[model samples]
Target: MVPVTRITIQDVAREAGVSVATVDRVLNRRAGVRSDTVKRVEAAADKLAYQPDRLAARLARARDYRFCFVLPTGTNTFMQSLHSEVEATAARLTAERIRISVRLVDVFDGLALAEELERLGEDFDGVAVVALDHPAVREAINGLADAGVKVVTLVSDAPGSKRVHYVGIDNTAAGRTAAMLLGRFVGPRKGKVGLIAGSLALRDHVERQFGFEQVMAREFPQLEVLPVREGRDDFEKVETVTAALLAETPDLVGIYNVGAGNRGIVAALEATERSGEVIFLAHDLTPFTRKHLVRGTIDAIVNQDPGHQARSAARVLLSACEDTPIVPDQERIRIDVFLRDNIP
Candidate 1:
């Protein structure tokens, strides 16, 4: 086991090049410390991740640590489950002197997401966001970190940001796995494969598609991956897209839904009476998808547990506040592949 290094006021004093008395005064908000010295002490404390003694001779203490979750607003079952997980996690952690609030935003809009993060500011000690791969979002995340608010990218991530941690599976690997599954399922057949996504702006979806195409180009040269369609995770939109694809491309033998709107895909296939004709694969293992998997509508599902992500994000925020060491293995989210025979 790795050792846990406990941070103390002496360590902060040494890092700040000051005496223990100065560190104490800075922490307690005493009037004797100079402004520059106080800033140095605070910076050292933050760098060392110093956790103050909140329960020192106090009967009850206010919840001074606040965390926020910024989730995408949509009807995707997986996103809905993630939102519920955060709410349940918040309810369970009420007595721990921590407050968690969730905000819904349009994750596909880079400007809107950037504005939301900019508004968060110092109101939240930590923020967990399902970020888009946008320059504006990255800048906003950096601004939050500069203001002493820890940021964690959840589910989807923003590249080149100052996020303290990421709480999700390896999306690239998941996408490559999806391609392998589809290629093998359509073994030795030469046909086109269709792809559907909520939005290419999402880092997770982009990475997934990249990995899928990489694998297909390298290993499965026999199959051709067609241009992807953005359905925005809406059932009706996905249905229309799928129906159009079926009508336009008769050689489509496989499909991989990298995002949500599973019901829409099913509706399109069933309406066209092509239910068992194509190799259909998707992400997320919910009640609706599980049923389809059992009924042979969906060949396989590459899934990530939303419960694991929600708990890990919350625990990571709490650890940042408490200056505790994190177990990387415990916090690692697994990429699960589920089939009809292995639904459990």
Candidate 2:
């Protein structure tokens, strides 16, 4: 187990190569500090896992804070797990004087998400979302921020927006990790690799695909990546597209699903008599994926812990609402990789 250390202003100053006074100025949200210096201070604070000593500092004063979480409504196990975490964490957060509510929208409807964000108004102090990257959605997020709403993007991000923070893993790095595993597993076998996703409209999916392609081109140039199949996170669509791809590319030796709907992919894979011939990689660990892993059908699973994400998002939003600085290390979510031998 990692030991927890309480970070102080001095620690942050030393980490940032600055003085305690400079750290104080930045922490106090004071003026006259250069933007670069402020960033360095903030980065150091995060790296040091600095949280205000609530027991000793007067900043611990708390009041009722209203917050909302916007998630997609779907049969996807990952989304369900995320929602459950939000619900489960709510009671604990309520004890801290933070009231939480969850709102579900159409799985891929950006317009619906925009309307939800716009409708929130001043009724809620902060909002966290499993974002869908769209112009209207970005506009809605910015509009809320303009109205003094603390916005935090969860799982996915709305780039070019003034959202207070993004609470998720670096998708590009996750993709690169997936590619590295896939390349090594495929060995010297030169064959086409199938890529499937919910939608490129989602920044996470696009970034993952981009990273996968970049690594593949650089390290596994011999392996060809087939045209991406957009399954829209629907089991029927994913299954159909995956089956069709298998039919078209007899030389397909690997597949990477960057989004949900792993069940569909698994069904299609099971229909074939290839055994371990095709290597499968996907995001998220659920009952369905776990079963595939135990059977040795799916070669590897790349997952994000929704429970940690939900809790982190809440902490960040609460801090934003209370004018408290966040511990960057605490808010950083990790990507978990699993193999058949390491299913736990």
CA lDDT of 294 in candidate 2?
A: 86
By lDDT, who's the top model here? 1
Off by over 4 Å in 1: 1-62
What RMSD value applies to candidate 1? 5.5
How much is 3 displaced in model 2, in angstroms? 20
lDDT of 1 by residue, 28-74 (tens): 67798889999999999999999865444122445457899999998
Q: Which ten residues in a row have the lowest lDDT in candidate 1?
A: 54-63
Per-residue lDDT over 1-344 for candidate 2, one digit per residue giving the tens place of the 0 to 100 score = 99977788899999999999999899889998999999999999888888766534433555577899999887778989999999999988766667899999973888988999999967898999878888889999999999999999999998788899999989999999999999999999999999999988889999999999999999999999988999988888999999998889999999999999988888888898654899999899898899888898888999999999999998898788768779998889999999988877
Give every collision pair in model 2.
none
List the pairs of residues colliding in candidate 1: none
Model 1 quality (TM-score): 0.84
